[model samples]
Target: MLKDFKAFIMRGNVVDMAVGVVIGASFGGIVKSLVDDVLMPPIGLLLGRVDFSNLYLILREGTAPGPYAALAEAKKAGAVTLNLGLFANTVINFIIVALAIFLVVRAVNRLQAMQKSKEPEAAPSTRECPFCASTISIKAVRCPQCTSALAE
Candidate 1:
């Protein structure tokens, strides 16, 4: 049972899956950072300086007064809030990751197609006899039908 378990864990597919999971998690973090730090700021600036991360709805008022400065402050003050900005950022991150994966898969498929196209095709080994118009193997020394000596 221990040997079987070791074999299962060491299988190529299992190892590949484990590596893929780890890389995918790291890639997700990168995509998230790209969306939050790189893309959103410029987009927000173009859209009249609207900060996506700050866009939220206050369900319940904070302890002090009307408007809470930030989401953290609102949460700290025990205010119920809908963090729409963070949700938007997450959605963007997903889109970026999905697009990147799509591009990678597309490139892999193209490479596979090119490889298939470059493969050599099998050539026909039989030829028609000029005398009898019968098909004969190229290796035949004599025509079986007409008894003619074939040229080497």
Candidate 2:
């Protein structure tokens, strides 16, 4: 059982999957930062400095009364709030990551297709035997299936 488990873990697919998972996590982090830090800031600035992360709806009043400026402030006051901005940020992050993966897959598929098209095809070098109708090499002097001699 232990050897079988070791073989399973050492397989090409399993190793590739582990590498993919690690790279995917790293890519997710980069995309998250790009969305939150790079993209959101410009969008917020263009929209009159409206910070989307702070955009939320308070469902219940907390110890601190109405008029909460930021989502962090509302959370600090124990207010139950719907975080629409964070959700939007997450959506943007997902789109970026998905697009990146799609582009990579498209490129890999194109490369593999091109490689397949470039390979030379081998010509068939065999023919059917006159007596037995069995396939035999053009260089054969006798049919192996029927032991019949052939014309030169």
Candidate 3:
């Protein structure tokens, strides 16, 4: 059982999956930062200086009866809130990540296509003999099966 477990752990795919998961987690963090710090600010500024971070609706009022300044304040006050801005921000993050992945995949596919194009094309190995009812090499000047002269 231990040996089986060890074999499973040592497999190339398992190791690769683990590495991918770790990298993906870090990549998620970077994307999140990109959405929050870099992208949102410019977008917010473009949209008439609207701050997305603080945009929320209080579903149920907490101890306070009226307007809350931020999402955090509402949360801290035990308010049920709809974080519309956060949801929108997350959607944007998803789009950015998806676009990046699409571009990478497109580039990889292009490279693969280029590699395939670079490979030397193989010559035809077999051809139907006109004189005989048999298949023969395309290079053959004569059909071996029927012993007939073949045309060029």
Best by TM-score: 2
Which of candidates 2 and 3 is the stronger one according to TM-score?
2
TM-score pick, better of 1 and 3: 3
Name the candidate that leads on lDDT: 2
Off by over 4 Å in 3: 123-152
Sort by lDDT, top down from the best: 2, 1, 3
Over 24-89, each residue of candidate 2 has an lDDT whose tens digit, in order, gives 999999999999999999999999997988989999978989788889999999999999999999
Task: Give the residue spans of candidate 1 off by over 4 A.
Answer: 62-64, 121-152
lDDT of 3 by residue, 42-119 (tens): 989999987899888888999876677778989988899998889988998899889988998999999999999999
The residue pairs found clashing in candidate 3 are none
Candidate 1 local lDDT, 24-133, one digit each (tens): 99999999888888999999999999889988999888786658878888888888899999999988888889899999999999999999999998898998887898
TM-score for candidate 3: 0.76
Ranking by TM-score: 2, 3, 1
The TM-score, computed over Cα atoms with residue i paired to residue i, of candidate 1 is: 0.74
The count of backbone overlaps in candidate 2 is 0
Error of 2 at 25 (Å): 0.3
